[model samples]
Target: MMIDFMTLRADFPLLQQKNRGKPLVYLDSGATNQKPQSVIDAMNQYYISDNANIHRGVYELSERATYQYEKVRHDIKEFINAAHTEEIIFTAGTTAGINLVAQSYGRSKLKVLDEIIVSAMEHHSNIVPWQLLAEQVGANLRVVPITDNGEMDLEAYEKLFTARTKIVAIAHASNALGTINPLKQMIQIAHAHNVPVLVDGAQAFPHMPVDVQDLDCDFYTFSSHKAYGPTGVGVLYGKQKLLEKMPPYQGGGDMIESVTFARTTYSKLPFKFEAGTPNISGVIGFGAAIRYLQQVGMQNIAVHEAELLAYATQQLVTIPGLKIIGTAAEKVGVISFVLDGVHPHDIGTILDDHGIAVRAGHHCAMPVMERFNVPATVRASFGLYNTHADIDALVSGLKDVLRLFK
Candidate 1:
């Protein structure tokens, strides 16, 4: 089916606005996606009518609110193709989800001199939690190196496994480099070594469909904001067996069967992990966003972004003294590039004057920057609502940057 790109673009209210007297050319979707009208309405509708605390009150309003909230959990389970709804645990965001696994699973499983495997392209969310876990448990980290084209070295990745390898924490796709790692193969390899794997799916969720069952990853996580949903919400999918073995990450109301002066019993699989009042409105809005993506179709979105990535790369390389970073064979619509004799910050500033938004910094993946031996690069990431015209504006802006610097 041919998608009406312009019609879909109109759904995003932010895209209709102007910036600095020029039409907004948003290319920084890797940071966060602009919400569509439907998602906004979903949240507003909850606030307007069904405003009540969930799961404790027997009142009609509270029941309605609680139903809306729990319904999203099932929606997310279907969205990611998990085996059971009990495996899906909502957290603050991807960072919180990863840290929850690290504290609850990693701390309990790992021992002294144990190793956690990660790649060089990991975002700090994936890196820091493991680092803290290792430090706390007298463990070490084994990093799988990346090639010049930004693909993970599979041979080295296989070699990283040892008897003491506790867990493998990796990214489904690199947020800074746009490299789609061989996640299935990596998971298989980790499983062969009897080590569980956790995938940080923040970048992959926006561009592609993720099946946690197909991947067989022990834990998978991503933030809602990156997938055009509201902030303060994220998902962590764990196997029922693993979740049952691990203890709760936090203690509070709703996560317990009963509390007393003596020992207290915890709630069931998912609720045991999710303590305290949750992000009620954000979770409801996330359900709306998931419905929107399903309506559009994940394959359709992937093909559209591939076209943008190809065209943007073709146009960008034609520019003089410009070099693109992260040329992995498999990538989403993310392009990080550097120009001769110009700092990334200067490029970003010039583009901003033209009302073009792009990320220009280490992008919270300092190891990726260090691996490439560059301070930073200007990154223009794409989304489903982006157009060829946005890429054209970015190319024109870059030409202006070169002219001013030279």
Candidate 2:
């Protein structure tokens, strides 16, 4: 089913705003998506009516907040088709989830002779954590090289594993390149060597359906903000048996079963990893965003975004000196390009003047920038609310930028 871009665009309040008397064209959704009215209202309603701490309180308001918070976990579990809600651990965002696994699972499981496998397309979030883990544990970090087209070399990936390989951490999609990686095949290759895999699904889950069970990944992490939910809440899905074996990431109140001066006991599966007071209103709002996606449907969003991606790519390539950085066979709605002489930051400034918002920088993936041998690229990433007309605005805006520079 084709999603009505006009109707979906109306749901986002920020999309109605104007910049310099020009209507806004938001294309920075790969960083953070604009929220629907339903999500904003759901979060506001939680603060207005049910504002309280959860888990420890006995009051009705606290109980209601707790239930709503927990239901979001279940909603995500069902959304991703995970085996159980207990597998979902909420953190600040995807970076935090990766850090949790690195600190807890990596520290415990890795030995001096072990190696961790990652790809060149990894976000700094995925790379830095493992680097820290490797440095601390006296382990090696092996990077699987990418093809010129930005696709990871699967043959190279399979060859990177050996008897000492401990785990594989790779992104389900490149945030900068928009490549939808062959994760099922990658996971199978990793499993053949008895190595677990952690999929950084921050970019993948927002654009398409993610079934952890189907992928058979040991751990999957995504942030709520990228999926049109509130910031500060991320989902980390892990196999129950593995989470049970890994130690706690942080020490705090809610993550405890019992504590004394002499000895402290930890809580159960999900709680053990979740320390401190979580983002309550944010979790409820995250649930609202998931419900909103449920209404629009993931497959429909995927189809709509794919069409926009093709149209935008086709149009952007017509410019004289514009070069696209990633040209993989499969990608989502991201276009990273550089003009002949105009700097990406300059391009971004000119586009913003015309009310077209695009991202320009390393985009937190410096290694990807280094991989492409470019300092920076102007990136325009799409969302459900974006339309073909929005792409037209961007193309027209780029022409204006080019003329100004010329």
Candidate 3:
């Protein structure tokens, strides 16, 4: 079925606005996606009609709100093929999710002389938490190297595992370079040595289908804001046994079943991890965002973005002195590049003059820049609503940028 790009674009009110006297060309989806009208309306509906705290109220509005909130959890479980809804724990965002695992699971399992394995392309969120965990537990952190093309070195990854290895955390896709890692093989290798794998899926969730069960990963994390949903909400999926074993990340209200000065018992699977009041409006709106993706179809979105990537790559490479970064054999629609003699910040500023929105800098993955020996690169990322015309305008904007700099 053909994706009606025009119809999809209509759902986003921000996309309708003009920028700098030119039509808006949004290519910064890797950072955060623009929210659609459905997501906006859903949040408004919650506040307008269903505003109530969940899990402890018997009132009508509270019941309705609770039901809607839990419904999103179920939907996400099915979306990712998680084993059960109990496994889906809602948090503020991906950073919170990873930190929860790093602190709780790390404190519980890691010990002196233990090791944590991670890849070189990780965003700061994925890297810093483990670094802290290693410091706290007196464990060593091992990094898996990447090939020059930005693909993970599977051979090198296998060699990193040792008797001391406790866990493996990695990104499903590179936020800066758009390189999708081979998660299946990586997980298999980790499991051979009895290590569980955790995937940082912030960049991969919106652009592709994710099945935690199929990947056999013990834990997976992603943010709703990256997928056209509201900010301040995200999901963490962990296998039931693993989640049951790990202690509560925080001590607070809803997470506790009974509280006393002497002893406090925690609630069941999900609520055990979800402490205090949640972003009710955000979760309901995220449900709407997921429904939007379902209606549009993820398969169709992937095809559309792949075509856009190929066309844009062909056009952008024609510009002399422009070098594309992370040319992995398999990648998502993101294109990161360096134009000779122009700083990435300047490229971003110039593109904005042409009404093109792109991300510049290390993209929270300084190790990636260090590996490539570049301070930063200008990144043009795609979303389901992005069109071929957007790509054209981006290439045209780059030409304009070149004229000014070169």
Error of 3 at 63 (Å): 0.3
Report lDDT per candidate.
0.95, 0.94, 0.93
| Arranged by lDDT, best first | 1, 2, 3
Give the Cα-based TM-score of candidate 2 against the true structure: 0.99
Give the alpha carbon lDDT tens digit for every residue of 1-406 in model 1: 7787768999999998888888999999999989999999999999999989998999999999999999999999998999999999999899999999999999899999999999999999999999999999999999999999999999999998999999999999998999999999999999999999999999998789889999999999999999999999999999999999998999998899999989999999899998999999999999999999999989899999999999999999999999999999999989999999999999999999999999999999999999999999999999999999999999999999988988
Give all TM-scores, in the order shown: 0.99, 0.99, 0.99
Candidate 3 minimal-lDDT segment of 10 residues = 1-10
- Give the true-structure RMSD of model 2: 0.9
**Residue ranges of candidate 3 with Cα displaced over 4 Å:** none
Residue 314: error of model 3 in Å?
A: 0.9
**lDDT of model 2, residue 362:** 96
Best by lDDT: 1
Please give, for residues 227-277, the per-residue lDDT of candidate 2 as tens digits: 999999999999999999999999998999999999999999899998899
lDDT of 3 at 262: 100
- Residues 180-284, candidate 3, lDDT per residue (tens digit)? 999998999999999999999999899888889999999999999999999999999999999999999998889998999999999999999998999999999
Clashes of 1: 0
Winner on lDDT (1 vs 2): 1
Model 2 pairs in collision: none
